[model samples]
Target: MTSDQLVAAPETALPTLRGAVAGLPSYVPGRRGTGADIAALASNESHYDPLPAAVAAVAEAAGRMNRYPDMAAVELRERLARHLGVTAEEVAVGPGSVGVLQQIITGLCDAGDEVVFAWRSFEAYPILVELAGARPVRVPLDDSEGHDLEAMAAAVTDRTKVLLLCTPNNPTGVPISHGRLEAFLQSVRSDILVVIDEAYVEYADAGSGPDSLALYRRYPNVCILRTFSKAYGLAGLRVGYAITTAAIADGLRRTALPFAVSALAQKAAIASLDAGEEMEARVSAVKQERARMAAELAAQGWTLQPSQGNFLWIRADDALLARLVDAFDHAGILVRAYPGDGVRITVADPASNNRVLRLLEAHAA
Candidate 1:
């Protein structure tokens, strides 16, 4: 090829040469409701408004946008350490739990490594593993619609570098039993990193779930992922963290994007931790709604797994599910439909929850 022709070709294909991002699929977010008086229950975000103190904290930090945030996130880590009863060096903060998961994958895996997780748990897990050039091994959930810890443990091989455990898993909302999870952890090799994602832990059954923080202390290779987006009601601020050994925490800090957690996010998270009591109350309300929704759906003959999280999954007939979603849209009430099988209905405020129940009852009748 002539030099002039090569030069022209390079300029023409500039967009393709941007990076190795060509293979990555763009993350699909749940639809937002901008229409007048729409109730959006797509994403499993908390319905409670941010505490006044947290709002003020974020607003105050917004003024310092001109200055760069702390690269190491020292203060935020300190607060999280106190909250988790760990040392500051054992905590690492990120933009969100998703970011933390990505960083963990990057730090541990390389090309050809394998990461194991339950199928249909979190949409991001496989994507993140592949993004890091690692293989994704997905184990099918048990018949009860929860992570089959035994199957997950069996799926692990020598190539397995990481295992992601999302308790009170998404869509299904059923948690793996405490004894089952501990037994699974004991089964896995010590060299493999286990990430226990507790994004919805606050809404899970009180004594049924395992305490990942406690497990982390017992197992050096374990990491606990937590988020402010769920019960804390700080999804907009985008702050989450990992509690692990100091060595794993250091690896995450080194590989994660610098200053990904903003000053406002950090400050707001601190305030949220301080307002823990109020958040606990909100979680209680969501739990009550979850139970109510489950019982109502079960009695209506919709097949459902027992959900311990804020959302309940209903296996509806396709035609009925589609019609229900369309009717809801017409009424300005939005819920998430998982393409072929069923719809996941998250519990909102009393009024919104009642509206949803009434609509379902009318349609079911």
Candidate 2:
């Protein structure tokens, strides 16, 4: 058609999202509670103030805000490398563990490549995979509300490029045991990258989850993904990292959005690492509270999996989920509810924990 004719015709279409992005489910963040009386326990963030050192570092770093962040995040990556007993070349930093995860997917997978992980785990897994134009193969959780490793292994095929193992998996809060995970690793193809997502590692008891660092040392294909957002209480700052083979880490760094992590975030994360002892003390308190709450919940006749994360998961069918959702809403308490699955309530301070206990006491089976 002539230019005039084409201009005269109504536009048939506008710029559009890729089909993969358009067809994907929207990520639904937990509802935030704004009022004083409201108990905000939905997001599983550490319900504590940022560490003193971290706060101070952020204040110091703020003066440098006019400058661009170090594009390579060399300082932060080096610090993380030293902390994890790896070389700087083997570390990659990003906006969050989820952001690093995005880099991982895009760097490794081509269109139609497959990524396998357990269902009912981190909600972001499939989203990131699909966004990279990769197929997400979800293996159903076992009867105990944890990864079905055998099923996940069985699901793997020639096209599979990655496997994600979320220790102390989100929402359900079940961790993969070291022995089982090691066996699973041996069964899987050597070429596939296995990402051990340890976002809640600090909250887990010493031996509860896979020793991911050790696993990474043994398997070059293994990648360890972690965040400062959980027990370190740096959710708003948005920084996380990955420890992988130098080759893969370099590829992830190359794929990362430029200066995605800020100077303030880098400083705060380094400070948090330096204040490990103080952070450990806070984590110990949360562990005690978790134990107390678990005992009380069990006494109330509610069956729950022992959670290694800083949150408790109560498996509920549709009816019970609806009832709990309504109750929490009316009580001005926010908890994450997964339709057809269950509810995840973050372990916070004593008063908030008591509030949750009282509410659940009334609804126990």
> Best lDDT goes to which candidate?
2
Q: Tell me model 2's lDDT, rounded to 2 decimals.
A: 0.94
- Residue-wise C-alpha lDDT for candidate 2, range 68-133, written one tens digit per residue: 999898988888888889899999999989999999999999999999999999999999999999
Worst 10 residues of 1 by lDDT: 11-20
| Backbone clash count, each prediction separately | 0, 0
Q: How far is candidate 1 from the true structure (C-alpha RMSD, Å)?
A: 2.6
Instruction: Give the lowest summed-lDDT range of ten residues in model 2.
Output: 4-13
Residue 22 miss distance in model 1 (angstroms): 3.3
Question: How many backbone clashes can be found in candidate 2?
Answer: 0
Q: Over the stretch 201-266, how does candidate 1's per-residue lDDT look in tens digits?
A: 989887767877778878888999999998999999898999988999999999989889888889
C-alpha RMSD by candidate, in order: 2.6, 1.6
What local distance difference test score does each model get?
A: 0.85, 0.94
